[model samples]
Target: MGYTIKDTRHLKNILRADFILGGLTAFTGLVFFRPLEGFLGLSQPFIILVPLANILYATAAFTLATAQRNPSIPLLRLLIGANWFWTLLSVALLYVHYTNVTTFGLTTLLFQIVIVGTLAYLEGNQLEKMA
Candidate 1:
């Protein structure tokens, strides 16, 4: 098909990383309900948003991985932009205290933001290399 695996290795690897991270996030989100609600004392809506965010992350990861299979720069760029947007939203969430939260919840949220931001940064570098 005139395509070499080496040609897309960088993007493929980045996408794979995001995919794995998303999977882990979603899995953790499953148990997050109790801790987020009980320990953090989060409200119904915000707590529900946690799992929804995980779903979005999973969806984005799947789309990115699919895009990597064909290696479309524009599509990858759009997805990367969305990931950065998510990171920013996560940052905003840090300041907005719609409900109470424990140290664990706050720390977990911050760490997740850092993880996603780092992934986006790496992906950006890979995209630059692709160019």
Candidate 2:
């Protein structure tokens, strides 16, 4: 049986919401990474590396947001993987801090969960469309 692609016109709100959420995710990631040395007591090497990861995440969010509006390539697939990887890493860190979880850390962890969940849902819908 053949499948049909739904019109994106009806998804205007979703599209818009994704764009906004993606931007927020990117911005928050950048903000949270800035004071990593103070917040996480990271060494120089870790401070450098974590910021790089944040940069990559921000870039991926921007790419995903763009792809959501204009489906030209398989960028969303890359985004899905990147987002999942980052989310997993962040969750791991949160788990590490579970013994002495700070308010800031807990709040950031919750935000990451929300953003990852949203990205997962959007990516799944996009993949279904492709199939």
Scored by TM-score, the top model is 1
Error of 2 at 7 (Å): 5.5
TM-score of each: 0.74, 0.59
Off by over 4 Å in 2: 1-51, 67-69, 129-131
Candidate 2 per-residue C-alpha lDDT over 3-102 given as tens digits, one digit per residue, 9 for 90 to 100: 2224444333344455566556446545665665456443445445555665555565555445545543355556567667867876886787665555
TM-score of 2: 0.59
Clashes of each: 0, 0
lDDT of each: 0.69, 0.56
* Range of the 10 consecutive residues with the lowest summed lDDT in candidate 2: 2-11
